[model samples]
Target chain A: MKYSGWNILKQALTGKKEWAPVWHKPEPKSHYETIVIGGGGHGLATAYYLTTEYGMKNIAVLEKSHLGSGNVGRNTTIIRSNYLLPGNEPFYELSMKLWENLEQTLNYNAMVSQRGVVNLFHSDAQRDSFVRRGNAMCIAGADAVLLDERGIRNLCPFLDYENSRFPIKGGLLQPRGGTVRHDAVAWGYARGSDSLGVDIIENCEVTGFIIKEGRCVGVETARGNISANKIAVCVAGSSGRLMGKAGIRLPIESHVLQAFVSEGLKPILPNVITFGAGHFYISQSDKGGLVFGGDIDGYNTYAQRGNLPIVEDVCAAGVAIMPMIGRSRLLRMWGGLVDMSMDGSPFIDKTRIEGLYFNGGWCYGGFKATPASGFCYAHLLAKDEPHPVAAEFRLDRFKRGHMIDEKGAGAQPNLH
Target chain B: MIINHPLLGPRDASEFIYLGDASLIDRPDWNSENAAQQFYEYLYLRDNPAGTIRELWFHEYGDRSWLVVTRNTLTHEIVNVELARDIDREEKHSR
Candidate 1:
């Protein structure tokens, strides 16, 4: 049990460039019961379900690079279920529930911290909206508490309370919302699925779909064509192209999100704090480094490099909120590709193509939803039916006018 | 709405696009949830204390980036928006 989810998280959260390839050779068996593309959280989780839940052992997870090299390996790791839409709400809630029991679910340590999250509100209008969202989460069985000025002051005492910019009117607090080790979530699933005998192929990129008679039979990878009964596409950052290859268009936009860490400091704050008016969120890592992240890149590109203007803006907000951190210097900053959808929520559903399934379009909440996404996706992959939580994320939503838009923003990458 | 270059400090009033009534200025606690709340109170409340100079102008409605100048009764005309950088600037006010 020591290899429990949290322990593995201890290693992954440090962001060490370690971790070597474990199992599986490059030999494609020409056929598998299920073939999952993209070895990130969603793909690995889908593979895990195909094996453990359905007892369907003929499965394989194909990654272009080594495992966890995608967004799964590069995220801010904030886990929360404060959604406003029905399609996204239940799934995120389920993901939050999964995070609660991740140690038992994966039998690995993921450093799941229930430090609580506070989404602040600036204006009365904002307050009302925040309250509505909080109430919905409360009804959905999440521990959400609505806070006012006094309430916010009690939680975060070191803020610049006098003549400030975005006044600390109040925040919506979900005690269950916290963070975890992102990389470990990937390795834990990879290990869990590996132990279950799923073939996880790394450094093997999918070249094209083996579409036979309008049905996907397998994928033609760089090594060669590997046939399979069912195929899953889970390439997050670069998923749009892969989906396009299958003759289907997904409402996914690829954008870059940047994250930074301040030099390690003693843990002064216990909960994760975010600025409502300005786009900024800060959390202290176990390494004592202050982890910070903000808004998506205004443009679309597969490039991993981030712009510096946003860095300056977010840093200014940080200083305005917590002047005490004026002495804190940003040690390093990195960017990751985001598969932002029309709505800010994620989508994981089967496509119109026969023998083909998809598990992509997780905007920013991929880390916390790893296990639950895997569990439900596993269920979806095994039974050929959408999990109860993932039923509404169909690709036809846009055409049908049934979009699950939590932010009321369309799938434009710049808006998100 | 138009806001001055030098961030208008709490209650320290200048020419601002007519949004609403005079807003009050309240002190912010070191630890508060939305940090932007302190300045926003200025929109609804004004702390126009009499016979004193407050060296502050606010860009509450940050719609456009413009180079505007501001002056106070107690002090001479100052603050050139030509170089309205986003950096935090400090000016000592003699009340």
Candidate 2:
């Protein structure tokens, strides 16, 4: 296997082996260290990092539903740092690094395949955008190679070369990015963090917060109340509804994102291919089946399942773009609710509320940022200081007008 | 191969997301407003009763791009669904 910078960076991060005091009975134990809400990959990874990297094991991860049942498990499992924003690029690159060595760090097989992903540019403007993004990634010491038709064809042969409106020009290939088993990742972090003594409270929903003297004293879960000195909200889909209860108005929209799978076939797609023009993305799984997803449902909906139009739409794009795939029949489809932020970027910064931190609004790219988000958020929560990786996601940026809106299309995908 | 989606209207005028073999017309920086009309006319805009409407025309104002539509060749009926835009567009002719 060819080693990339992603492999080098993955060697840098570490996880904890210690655990915080568990609270089986709901009650404030004097002043526990930290309380992380939303026990998905973000929450679990945050706990593991805080305990390992920060030596702060006095932490608890509270999950409303079962772990890995949220957006973390709902993602298509693509991990790449091919971002265009200056502020956002390095952070996701850091995420890419962490993903490179995730198997060893977690001591679990995440099934991470760095088969490579190419963002095809069909126009001059698109090429220009790729140039800027590639330069940025290169500056950050990440791989972002520009490939021509020959290169693209060598990567994916079954694509249609003729009879298409937008003929192929070239693409941006990020060798560091690829795919992973989404659910196994969540479980690996949970098992790793649990071994370290971090409490993984499943089916424990945070109904509200206990605030005294303008500071969050504890959380009110379905089981009851528990006190902590600090708290972090890492939930994605239900982030809005959860924050609303605390009177916190976040610029987050609950958007439904979905994915589809084709019945098992002799593997054809070699790597992940994303269309820069339309909301099209696809990759062949190890099971010899095609797995893919696209733009989030623009509407705000709690519906775990979407309508029939999108399934047909995504598969249509798949078949239209690649003629060889026309015969592959779609097998199953699913939905995931994501916290679509106003800037199309995440908010991994301290909130206005005292002792409150947030790690959400990852949009469609959260899975790619799993390790980086966890490591950075752990640094912030444990030391009460922001890490370099997540400094760009500061809440003040929104206030300071220095927001890192890479798409320049604002928050909406239709607009972006 | 020909089917009508409930959400997407029948044939040309109907705004449906296409989950079939189609491509975006190669145009330089076409505005979103014109891109929709141009894309429809280029790949999807067709007769009252035609073959499977392989290309898409999603009404982005609502439900966003998850909607997919196709027209039946014989009955002129429409078949549509909310699909993940997992399809890859043929970029060779897209520009």
Candidate 3:
């Protein structure tokens, strides 16, 4: 039952009962060629690419909870490739390219709106840094534009320009960056993979890994024991705990990051805008609610909730830039657990145990890196080699003194 | 969240700056034979448990004392607080 305009019209003209479920609830098999843990966006995307790109078969995705129950559905839905480091710029640019063709590729509506993303800079030094970052983006074949104060004002006139503390300066604009329907991405990939004969088993929690000698032979789950030649762990916040079951500690810490949405109003923000002096970033959703978030709670926690101080701090930062948002009635807020790595950058690499792979430590930026993370993880599983764009994202980078500390926050997961 | 500071009784958690895992207090000897591996583990690896854990917090806005705060990561409940200097001295005596 391929989704198409003709099919939709035919179903509409008929009794509208011809529609099928988005994905099948398939029971887990005893064995599979590869087992992908965590049925979040990355896991599903990895399975999707493994089947579609590598022509692989007998793949199963195991989820502890239902699909889109993790950060994939919890993110602010913004996507961009405005990175500053060489190790990251090209990979995110590849993700940006993938997002451009995602809907057509999956035959599902993902609502990838590239309205643009503007990273605001409040001072002279910040402007210079943004310029350097824009140059880095351009060098990586990603679109970037350095917009002056006038340009930012033209895009968002409601910004506080005359504030005595941190006045508006300029911003680095990426015209090809914006928001996507977050949950739809998971559904699209899930459906696309399931339609291609991949089993997606939900509510099956992986309790441990079965290691035969030095190789990972299978996984012990709450449902039962399942075997696979290769097992890939893509649980974002649960990376540390999941891998810990195999007696392998990770260079990752789980932190709670909260996101907020205000009462629906008329459209005000044209694109994603990030505050320079603070960790605040905001964009208006299609429903006219302002979707925004700030820094993580700055502690190690698996709890998917935050305290009041961060909420107040994020709200203050929001008011510092766009004062009008202060008047908007607060609607709802929620937290998502994020895997903050030592060097801040993510890892898409294999582990010491043969045939066991790991993909996590996305910090707070995993949502934007979903496509590339999946594509690269699939490439690794299929070819047993890192993708060229993700070659630097090795598990032993820290041990080899090759830390990709993008924010220069050394060995501190919370700061990153 | 409130941190029951060892020195100052019951203070807002915001007054303190959180540094991760209290195990960081046990710095490995650099001159050991397995210095490289030990340093790697010290810098990268983490228990990151979902249950009760001890972590370091600096009283930045209040006193200049460093405290080892034992808190449950799952519930964010502070169980105990002690001066890091006291803990360091106790460990030294044990050694």
Candidate 4:
């Protein structure tokens, strides 16, 4: 059903009984041309693009649990393309462009707010790096603005600009970067894909791959064995175990990254502000809650809950930049499993095995890269070639010594 | 998470530095024919299991010792902690 202002008024004038469900829940068929594992935003968006762009009708997106139960619903929802690396800046800028018209394309209100993002720099060296990143972003066709101390203060006056330690000197602002309602992305993509004859099978966990004669033929799921010509895996944090089952060990580690939301208060934060002195970024939701997050827990684990040490550390960083955040009441916190890649980037490429593709290792940037990750992944699966923007994200890049070390951190999953 | 140190009774996990899977301690022999591939696997690949796992943790703040910690990843329960130096010496002796 095409939803618009006219549809709402018509449904209101009638009894509202003619309105249909967003997407139909259907049983899985015996086989499909392509099978996508995991029903998160990326997986659903992959299926959506495969059908919409490539015109592949027979596709299925299998989810272990309910849709949007993974990182899609657990992120702080900030989106940006402010990157310095050639491999990263273009890909993220593609995602940012897709996000601009996502709600209109999906015909669902994703609540994409372009309130802008500011990465505050505390030192001259940090400012230099931000300048380099801003230049790279502009080269990649994304907008960037270098804001001095006064410019930053004009935007956010409540910051601790004169702190003795970690003083805020300036900032790099991307006017296009902002937040989106994370779960709505999943729903919109799911509904759009389902409308195009794509099967979105929820609660269907894939147990193992059917690799016959060294080529993936199908998958063994909780429901039944379903065959497919092509199988694309985009299960985020579960990438390690799933690919390991297929006899492939990825250069990825599963770590829990926590996110927090403070109790709802009147609007205080003007926009998303990131602390360059520390690993903390915060933004105020439309509902008036301050949503924020920091570094991942420095361990390899699949746990969805974090300890108090990280909570205390994140809150301390919050207080360092904006001292007023200490007055806000702590509401709740949660963790999502992130597939931390070796060089802090993502992969969207085919494996050595024919007809078997993989898409993961997004680390902390999966939520923001949802649309382009899916689109580029679809392009790869359809054309069997990497997208121009995502060409550097090959699994063999590490073996070939072409690692896109965006942070310049050498082969450290936790540091990335 | 409270990791019980072998020397000190109990220490908070915050005092320790997480070094990932304990399999890292069993470093592959450098003189082997597939030394390059083995080292690559040892450094990059991980088991990343969901249940009980043996891991390496350095007590950076308290005892200044690198300890092997056996814990459940899902439940975050510490099962055992032993001095990593002792384990290294034992591996050397067995070799």
Candidate 5:
């Protein structure tokens, strides 16, 4: 059912009784052309694009749990394409463009707010580094503005500008970057894909892959065995475990990254502000809650939870940059398992196993790359070739010593 | 989480830097024919189990000791902690 103003009005006139489900819940079939594992934003978007863009309608997405139960819903909801690396800038810029037209494309109110993102810099060295990053963003055709201390003060007056230890020097701003309603993207993509005849199977945990000879032809799930011409795995942090069942050890580590939201208050934050000396990044939600997150828990684990020390560390970072955050009581905090790659980037390429495609290693930065990752994964699945923008995201890049170290954090997974 | 160190009584887990699986300490021989492949697997691949796991943790804050902490990943419970240098010495002697 295509939603419109007139449809809503008609439904309202009829006592709002004829409202349909957002997406159809279909029973799993024995066979399909392609099977997408994980029904998060990336999986749903991949399914949506496979049907819409590639005309491959005989697709099914297998989610282990209810939709949006993963990192898609447990993120800070910020989006930006202000990257510095050549292997990353163009790809994120494409994602930024896709984000610009996402609402119109899906005909869904995703609330794609373009309130801008400002990365605060504390020291001269950090400012110089941001200057380079801003120039790189401009080179990649993305908007970037280098803000001085005065400009930052004007933008966010509440920020701690004069902390003696970590004084705020300036900031690098991306004017077109902002936040989106995280779950809405998943819902819209699921609805659009369902409308295009893609089966979205929920609560069906994949136990193992069906390997015939040397190719992965299907999957063994809790429901039953389902065959497919192509099996695409995109289960974020669970990538290592899922791929391990096929005797394929992934170059990914699962880390629990926690996100927090404070009690609703009067809207104060105008733009997304990231702490220069620390890992804290926060933005006020439309509901007036301050949504924020810091670094991932520095350990490799599959559990969707975190420890108290990291909580203390994150709150400390928050208080360090914005002293007012201490007054806002934290209403809720949740953790999401993130697939931290060796080089702090993501992978969107085919694996060695024939008919078995892989799309993960997103670390904690997967939410912002959802659309582009899905589009590129769909393109790869349909055409058996990586998309031009995603050509650098090869799974074998580590073997070839071509790692896309965006943060230049070397080979450390947690640091990334 | 608190790791009861062998020498330094007990220390908060935050004071230690988490490396990863204890299998990382068993570094493959560099002179092997498939050293590149072995290094790739050693550096990237990990057995991230849902149950008990032995991981490497360095107490950078307290006694500067690299420890092998056997903990349950599901429950985040520290079951055992030992000096990694002792493990290295034992392995070398056994070899």
Candidate 6:
């Protein structure tokens, strides 16, 4: 049923029993035209686009667990297009545009709040770098503004401007960037795809892939062997392991990134603020809790947890930037596995196998790139060619010495 | 987390810097016929297994020595620790 205000009023006036479940639990079929692995935000979005835009049929999304159990639900929910590189700016800008019309398109309230995002600058060099980034954002048709110290103070007066080390300088502001309800994105996409005759099978883990000759055929799952004409793997952190089952080694590593939330209090932060000298970024949630995160734990691990050093380091950076939140008691913290690619950029391309495709290596920035990532993956699956914006995100870019390393941090995944 | 450094006994894991898979010690031969492919695999691909694996760690804040730490990626359990130079010499002798 369409979720309209009139429908809500009728349901309220009635016994409220006419409502239906958002999505149905459908059993997996023996064969499908396309199979999308990992029913996270990207996979669901891919299925949604494949059905709605491309008019494809017989698509099934297989999830190891329930939907939104991965990085899609684990992110800090901030979205922005304040990128510096040409290879990254346009693609993220496309995603920003998609986020603007997401709720209306899906007929769901995603809570996409464009409260703006400010990347703080601590030094003159940092300010120059931010200026360059703002120019890039503007060139890519995204909004960007370079705010001075006075401007930043006017926006957030609680910042520690007089700190002896790394004092406040300026920031690059993107007025069209802010937060969204993270898990709701997954639910909205799943419901929309399910309504369009796409089967979403949860708790069905894909154990391996079936290869015949040089072409991909199907997948071997915990439930049963299912065949598909095309199989697209969109598992974020499990990319390395899942592709390894097909004997395809990826240029990706799985690392744990931790996020923290403080006890609920009166809302203070007006926008998402990122620390310049450190890896800390924070924004206040609608629930009045401060949502923040920092650098990933510098190690290779599939375990969905991090060590204490990173937590302490992130808290220290938080205090160094905004001294006002020093007393807010830490409420909860959790970790999510991130597919850190070698060049720190993502890949949305096909593999050497004929019918197999891969879409992962999102690092810690997968949440914001959900819409574009799905749309591009669907474009690739439907037309057998990459979308214009994601043409550079090829699997062979690293092998061809065409790495899109945004940080220029070389092949070190942890540093990126 | 604590790293049982081979020389420094037990120490906080923060005192060391992680450099990823120990297979990095076997840098591909640049003059080989398949240099490009070998270099690509060496620089990018990793056997990021869920179980036990060998990795390189530098004692940056403790001692100026590199250690090859074998640990389980699933449980973060340290299995063994040895000086990287010793492991390098042993591998060279075996090779």
Best by DockQ: 3
A296: Cα error in model 1, Å: 1.0
What is every candidate's alpha-carbon RMSD to the true fold?
15.6, 12.9, 0.8, 1.1, 1.2, 0.8
Superposed by TM-score, candidate 4 places the C-alpha of residue A47 at a distance from the truth, in angstroms, of 0.4
Clashing residue pairs, backbone N/CA/C < 3 A, model 3? none
Docking class of 3: high
The residue pairs that clash in candidate 5, if any, are none
Query: Which is the better candidate, 1 or 5, if ranked by TM-score?
Result: 5
How close to the true structure is residue A269 of candidate 4, measured as C-alpha lDDT?
A: 88
For the record, the alpha-carbon RMSD of candidate 1 to the native fold, in angstroms, is: 15.6
Candidate 3 or 2, higher TM-score: 3
- Model 6 CAPRI rating: high
Report the lDDT tens digits of candidate 3 across residue range A1-416. Answer: 88899998999999899788989998889999999999999999999999999999999999999987999999999999999898999999999999999999999999999999999998999898888989999999999999999999898999999988998888999999999999999999999999999999999999999999999999999899999999999999989889999998999999999999999999999999999999999999999999999999999998899999999999999999999998998799999999999999999999999999999999999988999999999999999999999999998999899988887877889888
Please report how far candidate 4 places residue A52 from its true position, in Å. 1.0
Query: Which candidate would rank higher by lDDT, 1 or 3?
Result: 3
lDDT of candidate 5 over A1-416, digit per residue (tens): 56789989998899988788988899999999999999999999999989888989689999999987898989889999989999999999999999999999998999999999999999999999999999999999999999999999999999887799999999999999999999999999998888889999999999999998989999999999999999999899899889989888777888899999999989999999999898999999999999999999979777799989888889999999899889889999999999988899999988888999999999988989999999999999999999998999998888889999987888989888
Q: What share of the true interface contacts does each candidate keep?
A: 0.00, 0.00, 0.88, 0.67, 0.71, 0.79
Worst 10 residues of 5 chain A by lDDT: A246-255
User: TM-scores of the models, in the given order?
Assistant: 0.76, 0.77, 0.99, 0.98, 0.98, 0.99
TM-score of chain B of 2: 0.34
Instruction: Rate residue B19 of model 5 by lDDT.
Output: 91
Interface RMSD for candidates 1 onward, in order: 21.8, 16.3, 0.8, 1.3, 1.3, 0.9
DockQ of candidates 1 onward, in order? 0.01, 0.02, 0.88, 0.72, 0.74, 0.83
lDDT of 6 by residue, A1-416 (tens): 99999999999999999898889999899999999999999999999999998999999999999888989989999999988888888999999999999999999999999999999999999898888889989999999999999999999999999997998898999999999999999999999999999999999999999999978899999999999999999998989889989988888989999999999989899999999999999999999999999999989898899999999999999999999899999999999999999989999999999999999999999999999999999999999999999998998998888999997888889889
Q: Rank the candidates by lDDT, best first.
A: 3, 6, 4, 5, 2, 1
Q: Of the candidates numbered 2 and 6, which has the greater TM-score value?
A: 6
CAPRI accuracy category, model 5: medium
